[model samples]
Target: MEEVLKKFKPRVVSTGIKELDEMMGSGLLDDSTLLVIYDASSFGWTIGVQVFRRMIELGGFGVITSYSFPISLLEKYALTMQYDFLRDGAEGNLAIVDVIGSIYNLNVNLPFVYYPGSIDSETFLAKMEAVYRRIMKERADSRKPVGISVTVDALPDLFGEDVAMRILRRNLLMKELALMREERERPINILLLNRERASRRFIEWLSQYAEHIVEFRSTSISGVERMIARKSLLPSFTPSEAEFRFEHGNIEIRPL
Candidate 1:
């Protein structure tokens, strides 16, 4: 047991929210995939902010495969998160794989790669593969452990409800993504979605692939929201919920 533990070396990575981190047993296990399911009443935006901000702060990197927003809006996200998107891009700390314009046939002008065509699971997987290879090659000599947090922002917003459902049904893409993350090592992926928009079947299927499931909802107390988390691997930690207040560009997870 001691040898196995030493070989695997439990390296926990933060989500950038201290209280939530404590709830997650001091942070998530390296390479664990966290899926964020949020309704309109919840503070879903903080999902991206916390994961990537912590990754960048740790001298790691972040890759955003966004279908909801373009590069311009992403820049605003960076400013809101207090991180520099362009500077991070230049310094090899960020990569954006854009699929926003593809859904609407608009030519998006951005420094990162853009797939300006109809999106499907195949297209998403191909673009992600390319992005990962690019990051790996560019940081071949770095000793930073190749830790990267990938955010797949608002999938339903990208493919529309029916198409997003079909794409989500593609189990091959999820399997391939899992394999790729393990092969690269320390690749933590956070899949964000609008709970009210996406089908329940799709969410259930996706949850099978995710190591952790985080659902956000509104609370009775005004100005506060709830985060219900379920960990697949950590059985001792049972399902728990946390309350948070989102204001002044910060999310403070309140103690229960």
Candidate 2:
């Protein structure tokens, strides 16, 4: 019998979001998938934009499948973060698939996907499959490895609890398929916005499919006002507390 050596793909690195990246041991791995959950105020969307910017900076292509927020908003944030696809000659490397209409509007050049109105489980899954297939085809055609980040604005409303579980199950299935392909690996990050005690079951279910899990909670400390502290992926860290303040359109964290 002949022995075959597997080729190793490079890992995807984060864009210096210190705390967040550290939780994942350097950042998202290349060719992996992550889910982000955030409340309207969780700043999860902002984090996603930063990740996308980093991907582009690393000379990799990116796609934003948006369930909410206008395409214009995403573009504005990207620009604010100093991501100039056109000026930097990264236009061809970035794309966007906006599902804001009945038919998904894919802007590969811009790297965004928009979804309009409410999306049911069936439709959402179909569109996601389409996008994944397109990305895979693009990678094959280019003969280059690519990384993908999916930011689903709000998970609960999109599918409710019951349907959301089914959707998640489907995601796990997709991961299995991608793994079997041997052409790429799936690493996913899921962000949940609101921190509530009741959602533990849902979070636990998600953990089963996620390689790394992170939770963001907002706490008000005496004399410190309101701050956000994260429960680390490592249990020994004791969930370091930090003062979180958003200003000048950016998220800043300081030691408490």
Candidate 3:
């Protein structure tokens, strides 16, 4: 285990929230899978963009699979969060797969498919297979490990608990398949927004496939939030209480 860790020293990527990053010892690992649980109003998109931005800054590619936000909305939010959308090489490195978009747009540049917001599991699975093939081809042609962010907002509305579990399971399996084929690690980040159907059993099952789990909660302090990590692969260190603040977005330790 120590040998493997040393060989694959975890890379930390900040979430743009200082307090959250501090709690996780600088940031999340680059090649590991992470699950982010929060509500729509809980700054989930903000965190997702931050992770994508970090990947872009590192000259890496990322994919955002949005089940709720439209492409236009995602673009708007990303720009609002200070991401430069018009910059050269932006589209080349960042790919947004908006299921809300028309199917015609899927054939453009990247191999993406649109779901049209109304589809059965079988149909959805077929479209996903095409997308997966395209992604693999793209990665092969570009020879870059892509960071995939799959945001399934209001999951319960899309599929039943059993169906959702199956979808998620297949997604993770597909990621692993890509990882093996590319001879590179593909980090898949899942954002479950306000998904009440996601029971503890489901989460526990998912946890086995995840390397990190980040839970975000809002605080009374303005511009501040609390983040907790259920699992991590980093060296442990005691945090000082003075280092944390409610408004300033700092994470500090205090006497219990």
| TM-score of every candidate | 0.76, 0.65, 0.68
Q: Model 3: per-residue lDDT, tens digit, 1-256?
A: 6654454464566555555556556666666666766644555435555655665566565666666655556567666666664341345655555664533333224333234333566567667667655764664344334444445533444666678778878876776565445545445464544434356766676667776666656668764455556566556523322211222222332221
Stretches off by above 4 angstroms in model 2 are: 1-15, 29-38, 76-90, 103-120, 139-156, 185-201, 219-239
For model 2, how many clashes? 29
Please give the distance, in angstroms, between residue 86's alpha carbon in candidate 2 and its true position after superposition: 9.0
- Cα lDDT tens digits, model 2, 35-133, are 444453454445555555555555555554544444556556556555553443333555444554333443333433333324467777776667656
Candidate 1 lowest-lDDT run of ten: 143-152
Which of 1 and 3 is ahead in TM-score?
A: 1
Q: Identify the candidate with maximal lDDT.
A: 1
Ranking by TM-score: 1, 3, 2
Query: How far off is model 2, as Cα RMSD?
Result: 5.5
* Model 2 error, position 217 (Å): 3.5
Instruction: Give one digit per residue, the lDDT tens place, for model 1 in 60-103.
Output: 66666666776677678667656676776666666666666666
Better of 2 and 3 by TM-score: 3
